[model samples]
Target: MADLKGKSRATTTPADGCALCSLPLLVPQEPSSDIEDDEDEETPSHLIDDVELPCGDHFHWDCLMNASKISPVDKLRFCLFCRQQAVTIADDGSEKLLVHVRNEGGLTSNFDLGEEIRSEIAFDSNPHLRRTEAFLSLMSQDDLETAEEMLRGEDGAEPVDPNSTYEEGGLTALHVAAYNNNVRAIELLLRYGAQKDKRSNDGASPLDCASQVEAWNAVQVLNS
Candidate 1:
């Protein structure tokens, strides 16, 4: 008998198309704790219904989590799926992320200025609310286009939250861009009228955030 994980919501899911991963396991894998004494595996935060990134590989929520467990190291790293850099182990289970920038066909040089502005204006309000740190890290890496795209909302006009807090301070998108030391992006935000002197909730300016990140170049851009 297949050990169904908890109570699956799908009663009549197809046999061949197993939802995400069409491949069926020879049998449903049981919880890891069933094989070993894992106290941490008691309450599974992820469930089958809760799976994100909708892959073809359908495993138990706990099973998927175990398979995706990329342990932390105190240095730079990348996630296999997203091919983006991993910043840190956030208090939440998700890893802080950066944008994946590849220099294929030299798209960076060919980017259209008009298109950039259009893209900025296409942002939707109420965009993804989490992953501020990862977004900031991506911006810092000079993947400005991808960073802006991620920051955009479904409508793609303005960020979901204009005044949304990115970090502890008043470091919003504008602040993170400036701290990232991208002069072009810094200038773009400033020209677009992003507030420079705006303080974080902690009263720290974007300049302060840049300083902490050791983004000396951004300091120069801001000062200029």
Candidate 2:
């Protein structure tokens, strides 16, 4: 995945004005020499990504993502819809605000975020996904001891429903254990007869699911 590191794009600071809404941006005639390259590096919150807009304004990748949740895709891109810029404002403010170009605005979301940031990746067939959900609920309601006790109950009985799928969304108990990131839970699930090589609807092996999920810790525990 591409990384944004010494990636330099002369960060321009617009003139002082209302940054939160579409207020006229006032840029100083000349930029000071002492400005750092990444002056835009700081944000009030974590920014997901930078997206280029038809309005010639760039919005945070997630700002567009959240906007997508509310607006239709056709409204996402103004140029495509033959409308004026969907939203616009100043990009040089302390914060880049998404404002109405007043016509259409579409949002683009790069879903590869988690995989991009992770040092490792894995896939695990998550059969019995509800089992994982149930475990989480139980874990939240009871102490770790109690959660483990329930898992270990029925004398090494782990769930046998392969339909509890994950990944391709088909998961077994062993897959759930690895998804839970619990080393002992994995061991208990395996001891209770959860198959190691079970394939999911997407033909993902348990190891495959572990890799994609990046449960490296669980991967090591289960493989060993």
Candidate 3:
């Protein structure tokens, strides 16, 4: 982990507002002519160390660090605004904020944190399958764009199997969407090749799942 104790003063400020506090960045003063050459060679001074987020916005370094301290471990120091991973794991498994310019590509890469969560759930050895259950929960709660992204794997990562079943009740993404009366999610899943007649572990089809939740619109769509 990067040291968080340093208290260097910021010399330059960002024109755009801080991503965290939304306050204007502190501007640095012009170099003084009377300063000695040795003093000029000393560590540079700044009003705030503007750290760029994965979403391309910037935040004060201290603000970023404070956010990281309160975020969940699974999120892995994600951006407060965009929810993109803002930290990287070192070779020794230590987590550190990717603050250097060379590490910027990791922020801009096509990797999807949501896909990472899915993979982790699929590979988990625990019999309870809590992660898988959470993945299904997300399917019901996520917005249209997020639902489509997970189904289509728009981040260029391996697409999650649309037919993959939840270990608890063998419910697929389509079944969850139907139960929630999510018409757009249903459309996206159908377009992505989800089987309309596929049965769950309880022998319930997507229509059955919809009916259980009183999703009449989903039933009509499935009936068609």
Candidate 4:
């Protein structure tokens, strides 16, 4: 009976899959003869451990490590499949995640661009707003080249105002760049006429936002 109960419990646990490779969760298998001579065939390390994404999916630790190597190191880590929050066990066993909340307008909820600024911009037909949103998204993704094109109106789109504030947070492109400590983005926005001292609805300047986020390089650049 005890053996049967143990088997039942083991069977009840959902099988985990590697979110990156879409393979069944597995430990590194012994190399077979066909690949044994291939020097490039490296063993995956997550055979003995795994991490859980925020959406409750599991992936091999080695898969995430490999993915990280080809992606921007500073960008937020997300699930390879779901594009949602992902987490790994810390050496100290604590969990860390970045959570962004959105409001009805599909913009970040916590910050506002102030009623005055919001009223001045025509939200309905503003191509600039759309471009700015795209630019900000690309910036968040660390897609610097595409973001630069968007900023420069290189795709025959209307030029975006680098200083334009988001209706939700009163955040300029500079604010976003500064918060992310993206020095290149900051320089680009400045070149495009982004104001250094423009404050959000919360009265926080981009530098202030950088300070709060501990973006030291942003703080230094904004100060200069």
Best by TM-score: 4
Which model is ahead, 1 or 3, in terms of lDDT? Answer: 3
lDDT to native, each model: 0.46, 0.46, 0.63, 0.61
Candidate 1 wrongly placed segments (more than 4 Å): 1-59, 62-141, 147-163, 167-170, 211-216
Q: Among all windows of ten consecutive residues in candidate 1, which has the lowest summed lDDT?
A: 100-109
**lDDT against true structure, model 2:** 0.46
**Model 2 compared with the native: what TM-score?**
0.32
Each candidate structure's TM-score, on Cα atoms with residue i matched to residue i, is 0.36, 0.32, 0.41, 0.43
Q: Which 10 consecutive residues of model 4 have the lowest summed lDDT?
A: 1-10
lDDT of 4 by residue, 1-224 (tens): 00011111111222756667777654555655675565677654433233444566655545654554455433335566777655444579654442222211221221211221232233334756667777777767878788778768898987666777776878887888889898988987887788999999889999998999999999998888
Q: Worst 10-residue stretch by lDDT in candidate 3? A: 100-109
Please report the TM-score between candidate 1 and the true structure: 0.36
- RMSD values for the candidates in order, in angstroms, are 19.4, 14.1, 16.1, 16.3
Q: Estimate candidate 1's alpha-carbon lDDT, on a 0 to 1 scale.
A: 0.46
Cα error, residue 221 of model 1, in Å, equals 2.5
Better of 2 and 3 by lDDT: 3
- Look at candidate 3 and give me any clashing residue pairs: 9-46, 10-46, 10-47, 10-48, 11-28, 11-46, 11-47
Cα lDDT, model 2, residue 170: 65
Q: Model 2, 67-125: lDDT tens per residue?
A: 44455544643522234554333446321223322111122222232232121222122
The candidate with the higher TM-score, 2 or 3, is 3
